[model samples]
Target: MNIFNSPQRKRLFQSMKMGWYNFAPIEEGTGIPLTDQETPYALYYCHQVLPQTIQEIQQASELVGSVLTQVWQIIRTLDEDTLLYYGFPEATIKLVKYDFLAPFCMRLDWCWNQEKGIKKVVETNPQTPSFWFECTDGNNKVARHFGLQEPDLNVQKTLKITLNQHVNRAALNLGKPVTDCRVAFTALNNAEDLGTMRWLRNYLESKSTILPLEYLGIKDGKYLFDQRTKKPIDILFMWYPVEWLIHDTDEKGERLWPALEQLIFENKIVIVNFGSAFALQPKSIFALITDLGYDFFSNKDAGTVWEYFPKTSLSATAIGNSYFAKPILGREGEGGFAVNSGKISVRSSNNDPWYTQQNYVYQELLEFPKLEIDGKSMTQVWGAWLYNNGHDKFISGGVGIRLSEGEITDNLSYWCPIGC
Candidate 1:
């Protein structure tokens, strides 16, 4: 805590504040936000990490390279209306009020490390929540909440460098030789990732054209290059709600948005970040890993993932229960079915009946390795290794971590420095 008095901390805050002032919202004469049609940005991001843990995270880069080759192969061939799974509960939060315009993408929040090896996707963010922002806010909140300075994840360069790795991979994914694609980052579209898209665009500006979505006007069903060309923009990118594009009401009057139906049938835009990648059967991946002799645990049936290998110990069937249900594509502790006091309480959020996964693999909850931070409670820095397709069999760059103060990580939990 004494580190706050140090000059290093002062410089960091000063830099963040400067970026914040430069990128805050704009006001128009009408007293409404003059939404920057092309770019909407916020600079409330700071980088921090645990050096030793970050080193391991860096090693996880190899997994990104390994997985994306397989991931891209899967996406390139799949139809637009394909379905994927969300391993984390927060991902469900993003789909809480899904729309066609902001329909989900192939957002994955898997942990990669030397110990767990490749494709160790325990959970995912709700469309890749920006940990850098969470790290920034976490630092501010702790300081205010407790009236005491806490170690900030931003204290370590791991924060910026790790995010730099993720975006760099995304840029590489959409870079030249891959159809000369351009990026169009949308706020609240891909949720936290919209902030990340700008960071990625800055990195990509040197390699290729990084155009904000506004530059390529989206009209009717297609992204028109211009009124004159009107052929349709080739590259399609968004982090917005799917509902904005289309929505239909069911007999129960509950609004439902089928983004997959629209994206596949409506246009020819190249959509990366394929949602859920639910089509990739966990059973197959598990078999591959097991065939290779890896010792990780995974449930094959989506019906009973909650009975075993559930997201958190809290979600596990109370001690002796033999039956539990879970969404096939559940993530971040959402859509759980726990057997409580001889009662099966299945939790689900916005999972469309059409795409609801029914498979389940039940297994005992895993004892996720823990990291103990000095002056901080037990923290598990969940690693996210971002991979670009077609570079090599190795993950593109460094990794990101979701630090938590509790047993199960949720809501972009705050993380802090371990060494200092």
Candidate 2:
């Protein structure tokens, strides 16, 4: 059946025409105008998953979180030479020694083909989980339009609660009242970054302010300040990836090292998705956990880890056959390639200019479930957005589905809404 032909689909399109969902790109030089840019209509139908599936996903997410937490603990024990091999800079290694917020927001990408009978984790973004705007608001609007029911789909409510909880915990660390805490949310001036921040700012306007990330500076070499007002920022929520910032340099060709690091070490600023979370960005960590076996994990966690986690390793020879190779810190499918029978079948053309210096990992390949959408057979990848309360405890925020004709879900993949 063509799901898009229903009355609900037409109503959703009408809502789009009525500007119920609008987007504005942040950059003018990118050629994408500040206008709405002919917004795409969200998926007309909701994709439903069984309750058991949801439970298993949540369990798997928590297991991933646990393994990563242990990885952090293990990193601090490694020598400097070993740390550099794991893609950590001397500065970042120091940050790992301290107890910091991890995975304040994250997403685990999973693929499950019915014939396989198990969901395999494809990748993880433990720092700066994007797509909050679409997953929370757009998903609900689509669900309501289709009269679908999903008890765990209230993402906006969960986001608000989680943000508040994170900020409150930061306040305690700063020894300040939660009401007196000053917060700012920042991202690079790209369309996705800005739009996501704008949507979140709209929801958090009453509690915090939105500002440019460039406004950050150090005062008198002893304190961190918001350059706009030269006032010290108490807490910050960054949409930019922590790894990128670690390698960034100022316009004068000077490295931006230790400006953020010093602030965090001195307790002058509380940054969400804390610096330590960078440990989870690489694919090699999955292989590390896999090699450790189920001895360290709980019964459920052990089973989930073995079932969902893919066979991954830091070396290509470790992957005996068809596999996927990806940069440890790549984003949006960039610097990634699909290898079939030890030959490169597909490679990403969208490599980021800044991420050229990272190491790569080879992972076992898993097939995505085949689904029919818009008169075409497409591969579906489900992303479970997970939030960590800064204490290794994770809560399921919501789910986002991306479909594409190709095997890899890149920046061009379509966002399909989920139903009950």
By lDDT, who's the top model here?
Answer: 2
Tens-place lDDT per residue, model 1, 1-420, is: 343234544455455442221122345434333335323122123334345554544444334334433443443343333323222222222322222221122223443333543324444333343454433343554344334443334323433444334334444443444334443444432223454455444433323333333344435443434333344444444443332323445446644334333433344444434333332323223322222222222222232222212232223343355433444443444344445456655444434443345445332333344554435554354543343323333332334444455545544344332221
Which regions of candidate 1 are displaced past 4 Å? 2-14, 17-121, 124-129, 132-182, 189-191, 206-218, 222-233, 240-268, 275-326, 329-331, 335-363, 370-376, 389-396, 417-420
* Candidate 2 local Cα displacement, residue 238, angstroms: 1.0
Prediction-by-prediction clash tally: 52, 2
lDDT per residue for candidate 2 within 1-420, as digits (tens), equals 345345656566456432323234345556454664434434566777566766666666667666566676676677878767766656677776674665577788888665678578888886664656556677767766668765265567777877777778888888988788788777765556655676676655236766677777767657766788776668887777766677788777777766767777888788776665676766667767766678977786787678778888888888777888887777878778888987888777667755545688888877678888667898788777777665667777776777766777776566777666
User: In candidate 2, which residue ranges exceed 4 Å CA deviation?
Assistant: 1-45, 48-52, 151-154, 201-206, 298-300, 352-357
Clashing pairs in 2: 46-419, 47-419
